[model samples]
Target: MLKTSTTNVVPEKKVEAKQRQGFRLNANDKYYASIFLGPSLLVLTLFVFYPMLKTLYISLFLTNTLGNTTVFTGLDNYVKLISSPDFLSSMSVTLLYVVAVTVLTVSVGLLLANLASQKLPGIGIFRTLYSVTMGVSVAVAAIFWLFIFNPSTGFFALMSGWLNLPVVNWLTSPTNAMWAVIITTVWMNLGFTFLILLGAIQSVPSTLYEAADVEGASSRYQFFKITIPMISPTLFFVSTITIIGAFKSFGLIDLITKGGPTNATNMLVYRIYKDAFYSGNYAKSSTEAIILTVIIAFFTLIQFKFLEKKVNY
Candidate 1:
């Protein structure tokens, strides 16, 4: 019936043009699709892309603090950072923190994820409790760790007494403040990695495990050789996020130490904040900001260029 109607009314040119315009959404369809997707694209453009471009532009200028003038400095900001001891020191601390956070978070998260993936009794409760850390705010988590590490009157003293270890000033001392930051960051961030890894572990095919059993492959070997490789993508994703987050770690430092003890834990992000907001040195802050952006950009590009490689399932 439709074929007869089309043969009756349609011209050859009209039919040919309709064929050329195949697969496009009609107006109503486009309207609904836009309703679904428009908001998200708007948000991405406004919050992510807009600020990124602005930051890149601001990074090119030299600002005067008192007079409130921004002059074009070109790459002079980056040049100063390369020659500055303070910037280099902060970068070193940031690098160490990123390494520590990634390793500890991934390790602890994988261990908990493996345990929680089991069919053991009361596993659901344990997994939920383990994941609660992910819900805690960064400042809240750092404050919680402070209470846990109070040398004179906290859990560390009680634990130290039980284990006969020395009570340490976990926050006040330069030696332990950075370590405390790393430990707390690890504890708080591990839940995200755990959730990702839990899914990966559960997704491993039962048939593979059965085949491993038939071949007499030990559980340890099967996990190391098969499960680890199968879950490597999740691990890689979490590692990348962890590194980026650790590099931009200002909240913990601000809430916990404020980069205290004579700049013992002055990370790049903290230095940028201090220079911009606290010290009123907008020019230097812009320089530091540019450096931070470059570091983030470099790592993200590396992830995309090489480390972002996908595994065939």
Candidate 2:
């Protein structure tokens, strides 16, 4: 009985020591994690969170040209924006632009990705060409397209002449300018979206395709069933980012259209810019910024809630 009791006591002490040692190791791990994450958290606080909060605060006040608050306006800026015809027009145009750009960019990107994923001769060169635009700067792209959209001295003009098509004014016309901007945006965004989807497609297991082939599945069947299901997560990610990018687009509108001949391409971001810098209405601009942020957040939440469920992984 004495020997059995001692054995039990020794085992209990050993277990206790182990538990204490594990606790100390966990605490040390947490300390190191905090140290590693501290700089990133600090940077996010300073650059992202602080500016967002500042923008929200400034949106509640009427400010002068220098962004100095002159009066507390509460929600007047938002209310005014909601009722203004110009603001409403801008909102409609922005929504249309976002939809057009997102859809076209994603569709074209998926098509290009599918082509690039094919095992053919010189396929590597084609893939490189497809993704080359990812390295192009937005300013350079806008300028290049600006010349391309020029009525007489541009690529489109030359094409129209050769095809004997109508000499449509690409930039000067209100309807055409919006489409022009949308096309340019779609082209500019295609490379990144294509690259992402291409990688996702390539990452799909060859075994799955072989199985489908052995099962007598057609190419279309394999693509729709095996390929799409496998790459759905990448598709969802690309779509979400593309929507957000379209919403925040300003450079193309600024450089190519400058909000266009009749405010046709005046997206929310450009509207905010005009209100803040061009018109010196800081309150309105800040309000627009907050509204844009909310709009983006709302769409992203919708995608996560509905679209994310469709993703295979």
Determine which window of 10 residues in candidate 2 has minimal summed lDDT.
1-10
Model 2 Cα lDDT, one tens digit per residue, 86-183: 99999999989988888899889999998899999999999999998898877999889988889999989988999999888999999899999999
lDDT of 2: 0.90
Best by TM-score: 2
| Alpha-carbon shift of residue 191 in model 2 (angstroms) | 1.2
Model 1 pairs in collision? none
Candidate 1 weakest lDDT stretch, 10 residues: 304-313
Per-model lDDT: 0.82, 0.90
TM-score of 2: 0.83
Tens-place lDDT digits, model 1, residues 147-253: 88888878987899899998888888986888989998998897788898999999999788889999999989988988898888778878888888898898889
Runs in model 1 deviating more than 4 A are: 1-50, 161-164, 301-313
Residue 30 lDDT (model 2): 90
Q: Against the correct fold, how does model 1 do in TM-score?
A: 0.82
Alpha-carbon lDDT of model 1:
0.82
